[model samples]
Target: METLANLEAFMRSAEHGSFSEAARRLSLTPAAVSRNVAMLERNLGVRLFSRSTRRLTLTEAGETFRHSIGDKLEGLQAAIASVSADGGEPAGTLKVSLPPTFGLNYLMPLLPGFMERYPRIRPEWHFENRPVDLIIEGYDAAIGGGFDLSPGIVARTLAPAHLIAVASPAYMRHRVPPVDPTGLGDLDGIVMRYLRTGRIRHRTMRDAAGREVFAPLRESLVVNEPAAMLEAALLGLGVALLVVADVLSALDDGRLVRLVPRWYCDAGAISLYYPSRTLLPAKTRVFIDWVGDAFKARKLAERFAGSLS
Candidate 1:
């Protein structure tokens, strides 16, 4: 039992690269986490981590040990959860990661209902743009699009990530609207650059008739975040490519209008992502099912579908 505690501490410390971070996840003091790891090292007669003033790093032995035991921990946790099912009631912290604006605008509305239903399930969530490691970061789930499918992670698609060209009515007053996707090249484009890679991305827009053409717009203004790019478009800076879900309200209120409505870029799927656990925690399982139901009830798939006209 003491060995199990040490193993848990060691694994979390290795994942986060700090006893403090591991302690936070485990709800233990940093000193306790450090002591457990030291005890584990003494028992094994091998130093697991090389500590520095700035950070803690795993040693070669630690890496080997982690590789041998890391996956087994999940199995162990699943077994424990199965034995202590608490009469199938979902309880405990449900930690999740969500995209900033999308989570706020879309998901936040459904939370009151979820809370009312699952009174024992505490939601610990954060809004972040960057990709998160579900296992390493201790997140039960994440919701977003454009994540690389990593090992031990699975995604359930919720909606199509459809992007279309949009601009304020004021901006297009004197300017001629694009007759085709190719005509967008001549327009002043407010573009978003990839935040992590700092690379400008261009995509081919497809029309209802399946004709695809690449928009070769000159990037007059480049921004990283989508909100900023939308701001530029709203301020009549230029024609901007934006997610249909993000600007749906503006388009409806006549603040912004869709350009070349037949053409849209299929940016992939917005999905709910979780670790590929054989035996998922009841809290996580319920949340996944509940959210899926919510999306279906809201007709989010149809609403966020790629433009056909």
Candidate 2:
């Protein structure tokens, strides 16, 4: 039988199309991954990949081997994980991807308690802006909104992703408050430009009564990051539409005031995304439950609602 390390290296290398990328996913060195793949090829007496300086391509035999072992490999890994979990404590690297601001402001706070509970499970977290391909990227889970519902992936919503208009008290002091979206025309707007599209995001407002209003904001200042936009608003630069989770503290402390209190923009939900599997790894299972419990205990769902903002 081939060593699990060699099989894993071969599979990951094939999936990523590069030893370096495979190494990144496996937390191994490029040379180690390459050597393992070479060993696997030698054992099977076949050329698996056609390697070039710039690119790596799979041979015909390699494609056949991958297809034959794909599901089996996954099953083996799951079985090993299950055995490890049942044998003793849950012990493995728990890799996750999270939005930078959301991770820092919300998830990071729960890390200490989690570590205290499960000391054997190591956490590797990547803070990024864009949604990650959880399986392809080798992440155990991802936390964010608006991730595509890829095959074999599932999402558990943590809170509603609602955007509410906010501005600094200093900026709002002399300005007449907007009764609705129409009045926002006079206020300088600190708006967000989608990084991918380079297009200005226009927010449509809805109230509890199911009334809709078109909010036309003057793009006096534009930014891509929510943190930057929040800072810009806090500096009294202009009014901004910010997520409720980010601005909750600011509003509570009087640093920022909500505009058009009755209206909010529905962006969807903040959720935890993970592989949809019959037998989930213990580490991932605990993490999902932990976050859900925290959200319930803190009443974050209620707090995150834009209407409440």
Candidate 3:
């Protein structure tokens, strides 16, 4: 009988197109994944991959094998996960990816309680601004917005990914507040340059009653990261378009206040992304549920809506 490890190694290698990438997702060394693939190929007595320095292309037989085995293997994994359920505590290293600001502001507070409840589960977190390839990068879960839904990943929303205009109390104290988004251009604007596209964005905002307006800012200061832009806004440099999750506590504490509060941009939804519902490990499942429960207890969804509707 073929061992589950060998089959899994082969399957992941096929999916990721590189032994190194498969190793990352499997939490194994590349040599181990290579050897496992070699063993599987030997057992089947056929060449499975056309390996090159830069690419691992599937052979005709390999493609056929994958077509025949893909769903079967997924079902088997689901069955195995189901069978492993016991009335015991879940234990493992939970690897997660999160946006830095939101992680520090929101999710970090939930950690102490999570750690106390599941002492055996160790947390490994990566805080970054870029969206990650969860399956390829080997995250148990990721929390953010604007991530591509790769073949096997799923997203559960936590709150609205809404952007609202905000500025320091000092900055707004001297300036007349805009009655509408169109009037925003008259204010000093701290804006962000998108890292991926290298462009400054102007949003078309919507009011609660469905009025739309093209909002433009003066661009008095420009920064590449949200954290920096937020700091600039706090320093009274200019008004900023910031994500609601990034500024919730600041807004609550009076460091920042909403500008043109009735109008906001709907970027997307803040979400928790995990590999598969069927393939969830105990640690991952608990973490997902924990986040969902916390969001409910905190009423973050309602607070994150900039339209306040």
List residue ranges in candidate 2 displaced over 4 A. Answer: none
Residues 154-229 of candidate 3 have per-residue lDDT tens digits of 9999999999999999998878899999889999889889989999988899999888999889888989999998
State which candidate, 1 or 3, has the greater lDDT: 3
Deviation of model 1 at 294, angstroms:
0.9
Q: Give the winner by lDDT.
A: 2
Clashing residue pairs in all predictions, respectively, total 2, 0, 0
lDDT of each: 0.88, 0.92, 0.89
**Candidate 3 Cα deviation (angstroms), residue 254:** 2.8
Indicate the worst ten consecutive residues by lDDT in candidate 2: 70-79
**Model 1 TM-score, 2 decimals:** 0.90
TM-score of each: 0.90, 0.96, 0.87
Q: Per-prediction RMSD in angstroms?
A: 2.4, 1.3, 2.7
Q: How far off is residue 184 in model 2, in Å? A: 1.2
For model 2 the local lDDT of residue 227 reads: 89
Model 1: runs farther than 4 Å from truth?
A: 38-67, 86-88
Looking at model 2, the pairs that clash are none
Superior candidate under TM-score, 2 versus 3: 2
C-alpha lDDT of candidate 1 relative to the true structure: 0.88
lDDT of 3 at 278: 66
lDDT head-to-head 2 vs 3, winner: 2
